[model samples]
Target: MKKLFFILLILNFAGCTSNEEVADRSQVNWQSIEKDLQSALILAEEGDTINIPGGYFKFEKSLLMDDKQNVVIAGAGMDETILSFKNQNEGAEGLKISQCKNITLVDFTVEDAAGDNIKVSDTDGITFRRLRAQWTGEVSETNGAYALYPVLCKNVLIEECIAIGSSDAGIYVGQSDSVIIRNNEAYRNVAGIESENSNFVEVYGNKAINNTGGILIFDLPGLTQYGEHIKVYDNLIQENNHRNFAPAGNIVGVVPPGTGLMILATRNVEVFNNQIIDNRTVGAAIVSYELVAAISEEEAVEADETQAGSAERINSDYELDENYNPHVGNIYFHDNNFQNSKWFATFQHDFGKLFNFKSPFNPPDIVFDGFMEAERSPAEILCIQEKQKLVFINLDAPNDLEDLNENIAPFVCD
Candidate 1:
C-alpha cells in the first residue's frame, strides 16, 4: 500500500510540473507568425472573432487594438498558445488594448513584456479568462510591473487566470470599478494580487502563494479614486515570504516579506474565511499610511525612543490631496484561519524591522497600527472575530507606540 501511494504521489507531482513548465520553442516561423498576428489585429473589426491556433510565437513590437467593440481574441489554450515578448523593442506591453468596449481575451499565455505583460486601459466590459501572463526567468526588479493589468476600466471580470514573476503586482486592478477577480492563481511576484484606489471590487476563490505579499488593498495618494467597498474572502494565501524585488521609488517596495494580507490606508474593506498560513511575518496587518511613510526616515524612526511621535513630524514632508484620507477605518476581519509556521518576523524591510522591534518572538497573527479618526471609536473603525485563539496587537501608532497592548475590548463589536 505504501509503495502504491508513493507511486501515485510522484505521478501527480509530475503531471502538475508538466502543466506549469513552459513549452519549448526552439524552431518556429517567428517573423511570419508576427506579421500574420499583427495583420489580424489591425484588420479586426467590431464583433470580430480573431482565433489564434496553438503554437509559440515571438514578436518584437506590441500587438495593439483600439476603438473596437465586442471583439473576441481567442487562443487554443493557455498553455498551448504562447506570445513571447522577451525580445520586444517597440512598446511597453505585449498586448495593449485601449478605448475598446466589451472586449474579451481568452485562453492565451503572454510573457516577458517591457512593461506590463497585458494592459487594457480606458475600456468598458473587459474580460480575461483562462489566460496566463508571466516572465519566464528568475524574478527580478527588471521584470514587468504587472502581469494582467486593467486600469481605468469598468465592468471587469478576470477569472481562472494565472499571473507570475511580476516585479510589482501580478494581477493588478487600479482605479477601476465593478471588478471581479476570482479563481485565479498568483505566485512568485512582489504582490500576488492587488487593488489600488479601486471601488466595488471582489477578490475571492484565489490562490496567492510564494510572493512577497499575498494580497493587498491600498489607497495611495494622488489617484482619482480611493479604495472603498472592497471584499476579499475564501482565498488560500500561504507562504508568501519571497524577497521584495520591486524597483526603487515604487510604493510597494515598502511592503515587507512574509506578509499574507495587508490593508493599507483603505476604508470599507472586509476580509473573511481565508486560510492565511505559514507567512514568516504577521498574518494580517492593518496599518495607516503615516507609519509606512515614516519608515524611510532614519531620523524619524529613531529620534523618538518610543517610535510613537514620529508620524507627527513625518506628516510635514508630504503635501497630500485635500480629499485623500490617510486614516484606515471601517475595516472588518472575521472567521479567518491565521497560522504561522515561523515564529520570527522578517528584517528585509524597515516595516518588518519595526514589527520585529515590537515583537521579537512569535509574530502576531493580526497587527493593527492603532490609528483612528478623531471622532470615531475603535469599534467603528476595526472589528475582528476568530474561530481560534487570536494573537492580536495594537501598535497605538497615533500615540507614537506609547500604549501598545493586546487589548481587544475596544474593537469588539456585535
Candidate 2:
C-alpha cells in the first residue's frame, strides 16, 4: 500500500513541526521559568493553551488569569515575547484578566509596567491579537496607564495592536460593551485610542500618530457604562502633537497638543472617513463634561485654543453618576479630509475665537464647545454633510467674520 502512504506522510510532518516557539535558545531558569509560569495559570483547563516561551521575562507580580473559561495566552511573536515590568513592586496590572470567557491574548510584548499594560476586567469573549505594548524611557510621569486595557468588557476584539509609551490611554476601552478597535498602531501615547464608559464602539483601521490626542470618545464622571453608539471611521489622524505625559491628575492630563478626534461626554458620535492633518490644536474637539469640568488649572496652559484643561487635578472629588448625562447631542460630522489645520488656531489660549477672524480663511475643522442639549438644534440633530473644505465653530454662537455659515440650512439631517 505504497508503504502505508509513506508512513502517513511522515506522521503528518511530525505533527506540523511541533509548535511552541521560544527563540534565542538555551540558558533559561528564571526561578524555573517563574515557577513554570505560575504553574501554568494555576493549572488552567477549559480548552487550555498557554505557550509563552520566548525570551526576557521579569515579573514581580501580576500574571493572573482568574475565572477563566476558554483561556489562551500565546506568545513567541511580538518580536518574540518580552514581558519585563522594569522591576515591578507588586501589581495593579500587566496581564491581569478577570472573569474571562473566550479569551485569546496573542503575540505578547509588555515591558515597563508599573500599572496597566494589559488589563482585561469583567471580561466576556475577549480577543487582543498581535499585541505589543511599550515604554522604554522618555515621555514620562513613569509611563504606565493603559496599553491594550479592556475594562468591563464584553464581546471585545482589539486587532493587530501596537501601542507605545502610554502615560495614560494608548488604547484604553473603559466600562465597555460590544467594541472593536481595528488595525491599531498608536504612538507616544496619552490618548491614541480611548473610549471611556464605553458602549457600541467601532474605531476603524486606526493609525493615530504622535499622540496626546488622536482618537478619544469619553463620557466620564463615575462609570457603570453611559457611553453611546460611537463610530469613528477609517482613521489616519495625523501629527497628534504629543507632549501630555498624563499623571498629574488623569483625565488624559489635560489633552491639548494638537488633538485630532476628541468627543467628551459622548453621545451618538459618528465621525466619518477621517484623514485629519497637522493638528496643532483641534481637528475635531467637541466637549461637555460641563465643558471639560470647567477648565482651570489656569485654563490649561494659556494660548487658549478655547481653554480646556489643566487643574481640576483629577479625582475631582468623585460624586457624579446619578444617571450621569451631561448632554452633547447627536453629533455626526461627515466625509472628512481636513489638512494642515490652523496648526495653532490663532492663540488667545488656543482653540476658539475662530482664528480671531479677519479673513485669511482656513480654520474650523470642527470645534463645538457650545455645549448643546437645550433640547439641541443647530439645524436639527447636528448632521454636517458633504464636506467642502471643513469649517465649523459654535464656540457658544457668537457669529462675526461676515457671519460665517458654509451652508447652514439647518445643517441638513437624515
Off by over 4 Å in 1: 1-32, 297-318
- lDDT of each structure? 0.82, 0.70
TM-score of structure candidate 1: 0.89
Model 2 misses residue 270 by how many Å?
14
lDDT of 1 by residue, 309-379 (tens): 10012332444577878878999988889888786789886656766777777777888989888899897
Q: Please give me the total number of clashing residue pairs in predicted model 2.
A: 11
Q: Could you tell me the TM-score of candidate 2?
A: 0.35
Task: Identify the candidate with maximal TM-score.
Answer: 1
Please give the range of 10 consecutive residues that has the lowest summed lDDT in model 2.
4-13
Q: What value does the lDDT take at residue 131 in candidate 2?
A: 82
